[model samples]
Every structure is written in structure tokens, then in C-alpha cells.
Target: MAHPKEVAGFKLGKLLIEGKTKQVFDLPEETGHCILINKDRITAGDGVKAHDMEGKAAISNQTNAKVFEILKAAGIPTAFVKIASPVAFISKKCDMVPIEWVTRRLATGSFLKRNPGVPEGYRFTPPKQETFFKDDANHDPQWSEEQIVSAKFTFNGLVIGQDEVDYMRNVTILVFEILEKAWGLRDCALIDMKIEFGVDADGKILLADVIDSDSWRLWPSGDKRLMVDKQVYRNLSTVTAADLDTVKRNFAWVKDQLDHLRPKVHHKVVIIMGSAADVEHCQKIGKAAKKFGLDVDMRVTSAHKATEETLHIMKQYEDTHGALVFIAVAGRSNGLGPVLSGNTSYPVINCPPPSSNLVQDIWSSLSLPSGLGCATVIYPDSAAVMAAQIIGVQDYIVWARIRFNQLEMAASLRVADKKVRNLSIE
Candidate 1:
């Protein structure tokens, strides 16, 4: 078959494959990587009916790329490499498993069909996962673990192992959690979702396929009473211009919301100092805090010599409000982290300076009294990361920064791997 005319520029060596909304083409530069692009077509009922949905490809491509980048940045494994264009993506090619993994946090459609007695709005406290084979003729039968293991498919020269199945289960839940938390911030209920995975050259399962408006059941205002998803479009018996317009509007709204979505950041940095001489350490702490968008204030006091003064400073931070992260810097049997952690509910992180006696410096932070819940880190950078994580629980801005850090780390590793692979080619 001839390659789609839409795929250009990357020397489309061969037409690798085609899916419902996308087409894969071989990349001339690399043997294992390929480019996938969205097509401007819509289909349902196993392509029994189809329509030319203008601008659908661009919307799906952009939305899917954004979601993939977000998940990848958050340290979720995925098959995405980079967004090549609005309708194109460069990805590491892998044999896709012929199954769709559906994770449900609340019952909606098919579950209502399969389990007729189950209520529609029933919530799964910890979420539920179901796998369906990708055979339209069989109507994608739900497969058990035994069935999957027995089929024994091989991809990229590696057999899918029990460990991989378990890993995908864990990773799928995390993907839902991340997106669920993201949408929750916007006051939307992520009713349920589906994701697919593919094995890379090394047999690592990565989240594959697209996750746009079509992938999840989204209920704005947390009420099933107000449902806006693809099912709304699918349920329409007649495809009138008015009905199609409504569908387009719903998709447009989803795209608009996603485009404007910014992770919220409410960060505060509290710097506790042992003495006036520790101003340098406090500056370092403040610098680190700023990287994660934290507002830092350095207060000089001794945890041991001036316990009352330190407690007073803590009270000031407690009263100021917002998400707080405390950095304790002290020398010689310091108690700032433990004292701060004990007094206030905010997280405390210890970053002690290197002293002539490293053991003493380490103990000052590590040896905490009972009931003290502060964590200790030797490096200032690590302290900032811990603080960012604590703040990320409530703040999306810090979460985004943490997510970016994860992406950069992964990108660096991939770059190193590419370098090693190129050496073999040369």
C-alpha cells in the first residue's frame, strides 16, 4: 500500500502500519524509530460509518502530544519521544499489544452493560482495571491474566513477562492518578479512562497510543448529571450538521480547557538559621527554593541556644498561611529540623553544611528525637526537590517543575543511550 500523502519530510521509507486515527511510517535515519501522524477522519462501529472531520487530526495530535509530554515529564513511562508537529510525532517504534487497558474509577458504560445490576454511578474506591483484546470481530473480549499469559505474544524480540504485566498495572494506575489530580484541580471528575502500552527494544513497557478527549470520560462539576464525552456524540442515531456541531463544540471545549490548564503553585520557603554566620547557607537555601518557585524568608536563631526564638519564628510562618516548606541549616548537634517539624505541620528538610567532622555534621540532621518527621538531605539540591515534592501535593506549579526535572533527567539518559548506539553504527 502507498504511504499517506500527509506524511512528508522525514523520508517516509515505507508504510509501516495504520490504526484508527494514525499512520506509522519508517524513518530513514534510524532502523528502530518511526513517525506517527494523525489523520483527518473519524470512525465508529469498526469503520462501518466514517466522516471527514475537519481539523480533528490537528486537535487530536496536539492534545495527545500534550498529554504524553505531561505524563512523560511526571516520570510515567511512555512511547513518545517528541512532538514533531501538530499532526506528527517522532516515536520509538514498538510492536503494540493487541489490547486496550481500561482503568475505571467510576462505573459508566460497558460495565453497566456487562454487569446489568451494578449501579451507574458506583465508585471504585481504589480504581479498577480491565483488559480487552483488540479484535473488533470478537468485540474485544475482556481477557484474564491466565488468558494473556497463555497467548504468549512476542514483541521487539522479548516475551511479555509477568513482571511487565504487573508493572503496566502499576503504571496505568499512576497515569490515571496524575491526570485525575490534574483535572480535579479544574473541578472536573475523571470518571474513567483507557490506555495502551508497547514494549521498547529493551523490553520496557511504555504507555503508547493517544490520550486526548477520546480516551477518558470527563464529567465537569463532578456530576454525572452533566456528562461531556465522546459517548455523547456516539449515542446520536442521526448524524445531522447540528448534532455534529454539538460534538465539535464539546471537543472544542475540552481542547480549550486543556490548552489553558496550568498547574497551580502556592509555595512558601521557611529558612531556619542557627546563627548570623549561617547567612551563606540561608542564601543557598533561598536560591534553591526559588528554582521551585518557592518564596523564601531567612530567620536567624539557634534551635538549641534560642529555642524560644526559633519557636516564635515558626509561629510567624504558620500564621502567614499557604503551602510551607522549611529548610533547617545548623551546625554542631542541630535541632532546627526536628524542632520545626515537631512544632508546625509543614514539612522540614535538613541541609547541613560540610564540617571538618562529617559525622557530627550528618548527626546534627539525622539524629532526630521521637515524633519528629522531618527528612534529611546532604545536598541543597536534594533538599529543594524534597521541598518541591511536599509542596506538589497541593501546588501544581511546583509539580510542573518537578515534572520538568524528571523529563530532563530522562532526556539526558536517552541522549546518552543514543550516543552509545551511534558509536556502534560508526
Candidate 2:
């Protein structure tokens, strides 16, 4: 083994090479590990326009660490190790894939250039996927999936085949979605992005390379005019030191917002039903709540028949510490909601079980006596959503889940609308 060398106070094995904005170092003690040092520089227009912005490298490293950590937590395979320092991090060493996987959720930029007829904001339902060969001298020309599959490229003892290309395609789309959801929590649109994969020593493909400010176009609040990504720095006509500082500040804000999306609340949702018959209704809410990280407890006690038992259920839960919201599941002459609402000060919501008497059931829950304070909702999804929204008030994770759900629903609609609106008569 080579004698360990020191770089930026850390003992690294050997200096491999340096890119335009980062340097790679081999790790002496850790086998198959390498350190990546992000530089305090920003570049665009094929490196013709560049700036050594103060505080950019540390901030980029922070952003990459935050994003990669979230991806790893979501079960996505990556080559990321923890941040080694403010400007560097350790990662599994892998042979690089010679292509970039780009996913676009909207029609803009080069997407418009390639497909001239499409308008801006033209949405891609599942998002449009493209591959670009990593040949900077040849301008990194876009390649089709067929060309990618046909090319026999080997990296780290792994051969690129149709199956390999397909797997990368699927994984790349998944990466885009994971980051898209993360950004959606901050009310930002991840319009499009590019990612590169690498084959590790064990012949497994991992999402490798540094995804920092330069990797994507982000439209905060879904407005291009409010864009706060590397594109902002790229589009500057005449660069000034202040312009670099301004762009650095935008990057700082993104990293700061990412810090707050992680919620640490022990909020619980209690689902109480009037009878065994309403068990299905309560479970519907429970299952849906589970998807959004809500802890649900189901209790069967008739507010009309076994009033004492219902009160006991409430008492049992009230003693537990944390934010609690009660959902009353009952139908026809509904008394469960009001009983729970009057007994406990926790937020009470009424979600009536379905039956032929649905109208009467809705009316019963909706027309609660003047001071009862129980809210009424019609569908199981709505009931679950209402509970989530109430919980989201204090839990950033819950709020993020809600926002991501909303973005998905809206994105689905855009896909369906595009299909109907763009169909050509053949």
C-alpha cells in the first residue's frame, strides 16, 4: 500500500485526478473508497464562463450530502459515503459510465431545441428520459436507447447490454422522482436533471458522481423567473463578483431549506368506530394514514350504545403524550364525533360509514350541536387527508408528504391532459 498523504487535514492515499470543479483522491485505509473534493468554483457554457465564487464549494458539498443522504434513506443504491469534510466526501470507487441520464418533467431548454413544436411548460406524464454520450469535444450529442444498448462498453468487469441500459433507465427515473419529491416539499419544481451511474468492483451499478448545483434546473415556487439553480449562474451575460455572491446565496438558501424538511414529531392518529360494522371504514382511514407516516390506533366503541366504553377509549388515549387527533367513524344518527369532541379537546373529525342511508348519515355528522366542534368529511381518502393535514401543521415530514402527494396528483392530470390535447388525427 502507498504511504498515506494529507490533503486539507485528512490523510488520503493518492491524488488521482482533478476535474473542472472537483478533485478525486484514493483512500489508503479504506479499500474501494475514494474522497471527492468539491472546488469553490462555478462554471457553465462548456467551461467558457467560470467564476471562483467564495463559499461555493462548502455549500455544494453540503447540498450533495443532504440529497444523497435522503436518497440512501429511500432505499436507492448510491456510491455515497458521509461527508469527509466541508468540501469533500468519501464514496465507493467505481468505473464511470460514459453517458448522462437526463429526465425532464417539463418541455424546455434543449428539450425544446430537439423537439421544436412543443411549447414551454409542456409536461411529461412519467417524464421524458434521454441519454447523452459523455463526449464534451463532440458536444455530448444525444443518443437513443437503441444506440446505448448496441454499444458494447465494459466497466469494472460489467458489460453494458440491453438489460443494463434498461435498468439504468428505470433507476435514473426513480432518482429524478426521489429528488423531485424532496424539492416539492420546499415548493420547488425540479424541471429536469441529469445523473450518471458507475459500476462498482462487485459488478453492481450505483448512482455515482456529485449531484450539486450544476446537476439540474430548479424553479422555486414553480416559476422560471424565480429560478435558483446553476442555470442562474450560467445565464449571466457579464459576470461580476457580486453576481457570483448572489448565486452562492441562492444555493445557500436551498441547503438551508433542505435541513428543515426532516420532521421529528411523535404525532398519533386515533380512529374510533361506533360498531364492528364500521371497522372497515376505520381501517380505510388507517391504511391511508399509514402511507403518510401517521401512527393510527383503532378502537371499537359505540358512542350511542356503549357510551361508557367510548369514553374509556378516549381516556386511555388521552393519557399518552404527543399531539393526538381523533377520527370518529359512524353512520346514521352519528353521535360518535360529538361525544369524542365534547369529552376531549383534541381535534375531532367525523367520517361516516357508507350505507343506503348515506345522506342521512352525512347530515347527522354535519349538523352537530352548536358547541361540539367536530369536523365532518365525506370520503375515506378525505378523512385520511384531513387527519394528515392537521398533523402536518406541526410535522414537516407530514406536510412534505402532503405536498408531494399533491404534486403527483397534479402531474398525473397534466399527463392525461397532454395526451388528450396533443393527440393528432391519423
Candidate 3:
């Protein structure tokens, strides 16, 4: 049955489209955006055994929003913007391609069916990806690269190319790896999952589609010994009330675990400088640090004038448990960057303010008078990003965010170009 046409904050206009779980509506007044509403229904086996799972819409809406937010923060390419409410979200509309891309780390289900000789527990060392064109009658036939290319689907006025396919393929793996690592940290095994892509106004492809309980296989404790995913519910020989209850309970468990999920940060720092006059220069370095998920403090200090004071402050940070990236800001025969780099074994970056008259600030940081090894950065954000990058080597959370950032930038450019073309035509 179609929903009552009324949802929170969203006045359902003409129905734009309907999927398995969501209904899209036209938001003509809302410039550059549209809304999707989650319904309290679940389907499996191509809607063969459809059922109404109460409270499911709310749970899924929250869970999808949270996951999308994290993915966006981590700089992943996705079609999610923000959650409007438990039942809705405001997002940029894109022309979705009718393909379900599945990435697997272990042999299961269809893999078992297709490759009968392969053992059930066999693991794919590098993971595998497969695409299926969405056709209900044919049950979404498996598609090869040639098939996808031949389909010739155009989105936002741009023809899909091999580069786009390759990019998505690589990204699919990275997304899975990031999520797998994250869930592992929480003692959950992300067995496998599927993701879909949509072309935005600029012919830019994004990681689109609703990823919820229906999207993946999850087994807590790495022990597929006790699996808890939709498949478990589907494999039930008979659908008894008790069986339904167990499935509901499992779904609820997944939702609860997701509610408590938090990305882990491994390092934090405050990049104190020596003077307020150099704030602009320091900010450049700080921006760079932020990319790596590093926390930077841009403060000014003078080792010569405030040697004792500076040491005292540094000592306090040293006592704390996390690694620090300090960028000493100084100019004209600068000594700050070198001084800090020498005093502490921590990774110190020297970012001396550029002075037109002296032209020696660069040297002050670059020359590094002795055994001191503090790296130098010209811009504050660049310096910050560098620090974060170095720290991120061992931090998955930061690494994931950095990767996501790159994807978002690419998507934005693609979206922009699409809009420009559309406007020109109009």
C-alpha cells in the first residue's frame, strides 16, 4: 500500500520514484535538493517474502544517516547529505544506474552456487567485485565490463566510461576495507556487502543507494561460527512467528550495535606557534594537518624571550598519552622551529613566517642548524595536513577520512560541471 502521503517536515509532492524501501518526492521549492522517505517494510528474494517489520523505518533511517555521515566525514564518495528526520533525509537527487555492485571477502551464497567446487569457507585474498544489471524478470543478470559499457546509460548528460567504472571498482574495495576494519575494531565481521552508484547533475558518479541491514552480511566476533545477517533469516525453512521474532531480534541487534559505533582517533596535537602576527601563515599548515585528522593548536611563543615558559607548556603536553605534531612559528633568523624540533623527540614541523624584508625566515626553518630534524611547511593547513598524514599511517580512522575527502572533492567537481552544462542548455 502507498504511504499516507504525509511525513515529518516533508510535504510529499508528486511521487518521483519508489524503491524497495524508500519513496522519493519532488521538492520543487527546495533548491538543488530532494527528499527520500524510509518505509516500515522489508523484502527479500526479490520481494518474494515481503513483511512489515514495525519500527524498521526509523531504525534504518537513523542507521543509514549515521553511516553516511561518517562516510562523508571520512571523505568518501556518497550521495548522502544530511538526515532530515527518522523517516527522511534531504539529498541531491541523481539518476541512479540499475546495477548492484557486490564486493566479497569470503566465498558465500551466489559464489557457492556459481563455483560449486570452491569450498564454502574459502577466502578471496584480495576480495572480489561483481555487477548485476537490475532487471526483475531476469533476476538482475550478472554483467561484465563489456556489458556495462554497451548498456550506454547516460546520467546528468555524461556518458559512463571505463575510467568511471575503474574508479568505482577501486573505491568499492576501499569502502569495504574501511568499513571492514572499522567493524573489526568493534568485534564485528563485515562478511560482504553491495553498493550502488548514481550520476549527479555533473555526470559525476557517487556511492549512492540506501545501505542498511539489507546491504551486508555481518557476523559478530569474527566467528562466522554464529552468523547474524539477512541471509540467516532468509534461509529459514519455514516462516513461523518464532522465526520472525528471531529475525527481528537479529535486526534489532545490528541496529543497536550500529547506534554505539564510533570511529577511533589515534593521535591529537596542538601546533603552538610563537606569535599572533604569523597566524595566517600558520593556518595554512593547520589546514594540511586537519586533512590527516590531526588536532592542531596554533599559538605563538618565543624560545629566547619565553624559554622557561615554553618548556613548561611543552612538558604538560608531553605528560599526556598521545603523539604531538608541533610547528614552531617564527621569522627573520628564526629559531623557534629548530628549537622545538630539537627539544622534543616528537614530530615537529617548522613553519616560519615569510618576511619580505628579511627573506631569511625560510632558512631559519629549513637550515635547521644541527641534528634537529623538524620538517618545514609554508602553509598552516598544509603543515597540519602533513602532521595528520604522518600520524594517520597507524590510524585507520584518519586514513579513512582522508580517502573520503578525496572522493568528495572529485564528486563535487563532477557535479559542478553537470550543473554548468544544464544551465547553458537552458
Highest lDDT among the candidates is held by which one? 2
Better of 1 and 2 by lDDT: 2
C-alpha lDDT of candidate 3 relative to the true structure = 0.75
Which stretch of 10 consecutive residues in model 2 shows the poorest summed lDDT? Answer: 1-10
lDDT of 1 at 210: 81
Where model 3 places Cα greater than 4 Å from the true spot, the runs are 121-126, 264-267, 274-277, 291-293, 320-323, 330-335, 342-345, 354-373, 376-382, 393-395, 405-426
Candidate 1 TM-score over all chains jointly: 0.76
**CA lDDT of each candidate?**
0.77, 0.84, 0.75
- Expressed as tens digits, the lDDT of each residue in 336-357 for candidate 2 is 9998998898899998888998
Best by TM-score: 3
Compute each candidate's TM-score over C-alphas.
Answer: 0.76, 0.66, 0.84
Residue 301, candidate 3: C-alpha displacement in angstroms? 1.6
Tens-place lDDT digits, model 1, residues 1-426:
346644545667677788777888878776778888888767777676666677777877777877786676565767888777778888888788877888999887889999898998899989888888889787788998667777888887866655456666766776787788778877889988989988888876778878887788989998866667777766777787777667667777777777555565545788787877878867876787677676778888888888998898888887876788888987778777788888888888888866687676688678778888888877777877888888887876567667656655665675576568668543
